[model samples]
Target: MRVWPLLPCLSALFSAPVSAEADDASGITVTAPRLERSLEREPAALTRLEGRALAPARSGRNLGEVLEAVPGIAVTNRHNFAQGVRLSSRGFGARSAFGIRGLRLHLDGLPLTLPDGQSQVDTVDLDSVVATEVRRGPASVPYGNAAGGVVDLRTAEGFTGPDGARLALQGGSHGLRKAHLRVADADEAGAWHLAAGDLSQTGHRDQSRVDKRLARFSTTRLLAGGRELRIIAGAMDTPFAEDPGGLTRAQWEADRGAADPDAVTLDAGQRADQQDAGVIWRDPASLPGEIRARLFASRRDFEQQLPFVFPGAENRVGYQRAFHGLRLAYGDDRRWGGVPVTALVGLDADRQADDRVRFVVDEQRRVQEQTVDERQTATAAGLFARAGFGLGAASEVTLGLRLDRLRLAVDDRHAGSVDDSGSRTFTEPSGGLGITRQWGEQTLYANATTAFESPTFVELADPDGGGGMNPDLEPQRAVNREVGARGPLGDAARWELALYSVRVRNELIPFERAGRDFYENAGSTRREGVEAGLDWAPAAGWSLRAALTAADYRFVDFEDREGNDYGGNELPGLARWRGELVARRDLGPGGLALAARYQGRRFADNANEVRVGPRTVADLRAHWRRGGWRLFAAVENVADVDYPANIRVNNDAGYYFEPAPGRALRVGLAIPLR
Candidate 1:
């Protein structure tokens, strides 16, 4: 693979000479449960980015762009807002057609993933985030089912910023325009933050236009008895975001900027209005251990038009969702038999209700008929506990266990049709065991974990075009074993490396049928990979970061729907080699950053027939600050490299490629509103 040749060079870079600086590793702490300790004490593969480390990514608008520096992860589908961002951790979420699956997402300690094992990133405002922490590998024991990985976003406290409002405006290529307003203030007893923004863009591809509005508010109140109360709310409205759809290789070669003809013909696109709110209460000194509780609720009204036109009907799907959840947790730190021990216990319960409807559209895009209607409900609950026991001054053993139960029910309401109403229940147990040993200023860790991912409601949608779940669909499960080490290379450098192997059964896969997405399960699969990263401050005002991932993912035993054996075939929608390099230098009151991303060639289908070639793209960003005023500029695809942002696996029509945007430029200014 392409990444192998770069390993030697990367090794040399980490060991290169540098000046002395304070060790940042000792001060870093992990916030999430099951791993809440100093970075040097944790027994997992974790990555944390914040403050100066996140400045280079702040120029981009999506999480995919913000997380590019993290290894063992692949992020794409950036330009197409209708489809949202696609993220895959160790190839776990590679099959998603839109949104995120097989991973857990959290914002301010509130779950962003729905009860049915699906998540959307449109609801998250990256501009407001201050820290992003990612825990790689299967984490079912810490976060219940579908926990291939965990992504947590922590926002800045209202008191952290200046005690006044700020306004920012930006414009760029492809008719991009944006404006934002923020207000924040804090006193000894409380703090509040409010922000609003508007954005519009005429995309690079034909028929691809986007318009969106967003708002967020958060407040914290200090209570008596060492108690705290907090509230958070956010909303997003996208009136229209055109879906250009995927194109065939010939079509793409002719004009990468062209949209699929089918998409233009049907005016395919999506509209979404979503809002969510949460309240959290915490008490520390009043209890034997710290107690925390959170309640959250969200609603979304969404609709989408597909490119395909069946016999006498143009396809469209719409759904109204009501979701709510509650979480309660407690953490205690104490000593047992002269041995240091830490324990945590938590309960999570969530429910999702969706009113889904299928419609036939006319050439004018007006609803012509309603063919299907159903009310689907998913309720889930989990009880989890984890403990860490110090074996000695240099070693610690950690263990975690969780029990999860889920119930899915569909009530068909379509008149005069077969009442295909049915329900299914699942009960699963997940566990993890790990050991960590201190190695001077570095740490070495090894762990084994288990996870399961149930089919989402969208995945269960009858492939034959009906109102009930597909009887053949089943949950996918996996077991992962990993070992790794991380520590300071020198006074000015930090490095991490991890090696892991996973065995999976009933691996879910997606395919396209007449432009609509459907799901199926593969027999079994095997995955093994190496992930490594390095950060170095070679001199004053200069910093460099690099990450690489190399993996071989293949089917161990599998037969397609056509009875063709796909054993030993490589998985689709994943690159065997991925790497990134970023360098930043402070120039007086301004800073300049340059980045390059590399992806290796990979197959687009289970048969490994269609291939997407390897490509490297570069980007540049710069920012200057003076008092409360700031100026920023960014240039993406500086080399104008043409590549596909995503692929449709096993697409029957062979229209598998979704082209990414070419070179583009953006500039912005921020000024205090006070």
Candidate 2:
């Protein structure tokens, strides 16, 4: 198979290091400079998770299963792998129907987000992730568009010890199964880590089945001039991932586990193959100022079948995607007017292209009509600079500015009646100012920033039977303000609290009619919230952690094209209040844990009529380890409650419910090879 040959070669290139030493790994520390800095120096709300700690969530079939208790972030899907996990952070990406939008994702410092601000989490192997870092808020200065926040996933550097391998196998209710492997080694010359996995699931819901395989390799090398080079490669292939569409209230009540009838009739689903690679070369200590450069690229082949057949309008779609980009950044320390100051400057550019076509497929999955053919592209470029100066012994102030330009173009090749070919561009400026004050172990901070989001080609090609970009569509923009504090509580506890408010212009919203999706501007919206997190250890080997988020996200001014007003309504898809509590006790080479996750009532549609929250779910996990062997067991939804895992906001016919599974059990074993 192409994957087998590809893995070992990539592993050999990265693992052939001269000599090195192994370091003990700790909690999630990220590569994003904006987040790597200490909490005392940052003004944004952020959360980090060590992959090893995400046993319950990561044990499942999708990445959404890996995000369990992070506050201000929501993840859910209808157990349909093809549609991917629908994720939203602080009410930013809740309207998405397929794929993730309104947020940014970076893997090992490489661009996972395309130039047009669309991204998917399906290709990255969660089993291989070492850490997860999420920054929740407006952030346009560090990254470009769709920076409603950032989710940076970090992979292992090299072999943990001299050289070793680990394997994990799991099986559970609903025909869930998974197998994963990790191998690594390092030396003075360089270091490398390789991981691979295969997962298959017979979902609880009818017509929900999935099969996925993935591989990842990372390597780094040292040069004589104190220079460094790191390379990363990954691949994913999915042979089958069925989509079970949403259900109406009556249908959901009748059979919570049934797939949408239309989806079953048309055999709706998708198959995909993705490959990506990235490299970073830099020298920070060799010169007075640090210099760095990065290059990355990716290719994907995909085919999808929707529920309807429009004949000339095309129902089945296939596309080939290619993307690549480069970046240059420099940073240094200097003294100005007898005061210390640090400055940073960088330039980034990227482009993405797609060869897309549409076909009408018969019941046997045979293509009958070739209704559409076209090439689509999106490009973006940006320049940015930042400065931070010491104000006093315990105070600091910082400023940053970024300028960006984005362009989208499409070429019609179907020879259809309409030209369906044109180009559009947007130039915007963004910046932020922040102040931080430190007192003993406590710190207080304030900040304000501007951000924006450009529509992706998927959005432009609205599946609501449209062939060209919606000329009425416009970019969404926002300004955010925030204040926060973080500090230690006595000698056994720690806490963090943040308050924020954001006002947006031209917020993009989705609507459904006749079984197709359409989008429009919401005119304006206001979002204000509070985030609190606490971790307490009162005694040796025992710990307690909790997080809470409360927000008022509502439309300040909104109306559909039909002149129906939708002003002053709570946001659909996100609860007004959410919280989580987890407790753990460490045993001899093992641990036991219990947790509860809760959410307040949430609207299921734009009209704020259908509510789907005010729900709570409990889970438990226990594990034992000795030497190089370990065993673990977990129970999810311990009480067997009926609840919605996700909602299809504003779906026509009120088909807004995607039910969650009842009580389930999972067990796994881990073994080591030397």
Q: Which ten residues in a row have the lowest lDDT in candidate 1?
A: 14-23
Candidate 2 runs further than 4 Å off: 1-30, 33-36, 51-53, 159-162, 309-313, 362-368, 462-467
What do the candidate models score in CA lDDT, each in turn?
A: 0.85, 0.79
Q: Which candidate is the best by lDDT?
A: 1
lDDT of 2 by residue, 1-674 (tens): 01222223322322233122212112334356442345456656776776334553348466654555676887777366878888788789888888788888988889788999888888887776767778888888989899988888777787454368999999998898999998998888999999899999888888788889999998999887889999999999999888777888888899989988767877888899999999998887877888888999999999988755444435688999999999998888878898768788999999999999888776566688786688998889999987777765566687989999999998989886666777778898999997766655566667889999987776665443355678878889989887776677888877877778888999988887565677888899988887888878879988877889888898999998778788998878888888888888888799888888888898988888897759898888899888888899889889988888888888877888878888999999989977
Question: Each prediction's Cα RMSD?
Answer: 4.0, 9.4
- TM-score of model 2 relative to the true fold? 0.92
TM-score of each: 0.95, 0.92
